[model samples]
Target: MATRTASCSCGQLRIEVNGEPLGVGVCHCLSCQQRTGSVFAALAAFRTPYTVTGEAREYLRTGDQGGRFLFRFCPVCGTNLFHTEEDVGDRSVAVAVGGFADPSFPPPEASVYDCRRHGWVVLPADVTVYDKDPE
Candidate 1:
């Protein structure tokens, strides 16, 4: 159970994970790009009860699958940094891979929502590519 720490650009928001990721992936959905202000969104999913520090700004939005989601960010730097779900309960939260101080985080195991992926976006053939999460 190795713990990992994550923090926002301005260090205003921080989080710690106590175990391996439940799943890791890159999301190319339009909503994700718009929210992250990037071509894609990469995340590491973790179980609940992780420690988090600092203040964060959050907003509720609907997902492509018609599910409600909460986007969390660093209030000071306005960096879209994490994702949380009411259905997942308080025990778990998804951390944006970019928020980690380490730059060598594992590559995404999958690329999801590829239907909306940018035309120029390219992924390795070995990576699992899905129109959306297969499960």
Candidate 2:
């Protein structure tokens, strides 16, 4: 199994994960844009056995549909690192793809929140796109 390591912008927070990811997706929701300060956010989800080291501050926010998610960020650089889905159980969490800083990590399997994506944004032809959350 290949182990992947990622860290925050300031290198204060580090994460290591081995094995395949449950899913990979890109989200263009308003919240993602605001949090990442970019056009969208991409993440890879894995189930347990992932290790996170260093001080990370967490922020919990209610979602668009009233669900809640927990976001973890580096206290020093304020870099978003990971988040947990409210209903994904305690063993599963998603890591920010950019934190890896690996150009060849993996592309998003699905493009979500297309409705909120910028008009000029373009995506690959093979990626599944969802206007909303792919119901």
Candidate 3:
């Protein structure tokens, strides 16, 4: 198992994972773009038992599919660090890939909401793309 740590811009909030992510993906949904203030959002999902440090503020939003998502961010820097789906229980947490600040972090395995993907954005040929959330 490898240990990886991700933190907010101000380093006030941090998440430490004990093992590699169970899955990595990029989402191009409109909400994701707005949430990240970027063309898309890249995330890595990890099983529970990870560690979190520092104070965080949370925001709850409803997904396009009507599922609730709870996002946690650093209260100091206002950086969105991670999120979890309300319907999924506490089995996993999705962390923003940029928080790791590692260029070598694994590439995304899936691209969701490709229907909304920016025309200028190009993904690796090997990535699995979904026009929308996979059924």
Candidate 4:
């Protein structure tokens, strides 16, 4: 199995995961836009056994689904590195796909909160779109 590495903007926080992620998705919720400073956020979910190094600050907030989620970011650069949704269980952590800094990283398979997406934003036809978190 191959491994992938992801890091914070300032390189202060880093993590390594073996093999492919359990899932990859995109979110267009208002909270995601504020956190990413973009219209949407794309993430890859990995379970335990991944190695993490460096320091990060945790920010817990209510999710779009009314559930609480924890976001981890680098203190120095304030990079939104990863987050964990209450529905996804504690064993899995979802890291921003852009943190890998790889253009060829797997494309998002599912897109949620599509109602919050911008009019100008366009997604591939192959990707599944949900008006809200289908879960």
lDDT of 2: 0.89
Instruction: List model 4 lDDT by residue over 24-133, tens digit each.
Output: 99999998999899999999998767787999899999865588898989999999998777765768788899999999888889999999999999998899999999
The local distance difference test score of model 4 is: 0.89
lDDT of 3 by residue, 56-115 (tens): 999999987889999999989999999999999999999999999999999999999999
User: Which scores greater on TM-score, model 3 or model 4?
Assistant: 3
What is the C-alpha lDDT profile of model 2 across 73-99, one tens digit per residue?
999999999988776578888999999
The 10-residue segment with the lowest total lDDT in model 1: 62-71
Residue pairs whose backbone atoms clash in candidate 2: none
lDDT of each: 0.84, 0.89, 0.95, 0.89
Error of 3 at 109 (Å): 0.5
Rate residue 112 of model 4 by lDDT: 94
Q: Which residue ranges in model 1 land beyond 4 Å of their true spot?
A: 133-135
Once fitted onto the true fold, the runs of candidate 4 whose alpha carbons sit more than 4 angstroms away are 86-88
The TM-score that candidate 4 achieves is: 0.93
Residue pairs in candidate 3 whose N, alpha carbon or C atoms collide under 3 angstroms: none
* TM-score of each predicted structure versus truth: 0.91, 0.94, 0.97, 0.93
Alpha-carbon shift of residue 94 in model 1 (angstroms): 0.9
Task: Summing lDDT over every window of 10 consecutive residues in candidate 3, give the lowest-scoring window.
Answer: 15-24
Residues 25-84, candidate 1, lDDT per residue (tens digit)?
899988888888999999999998888788877899876556667888888999887878
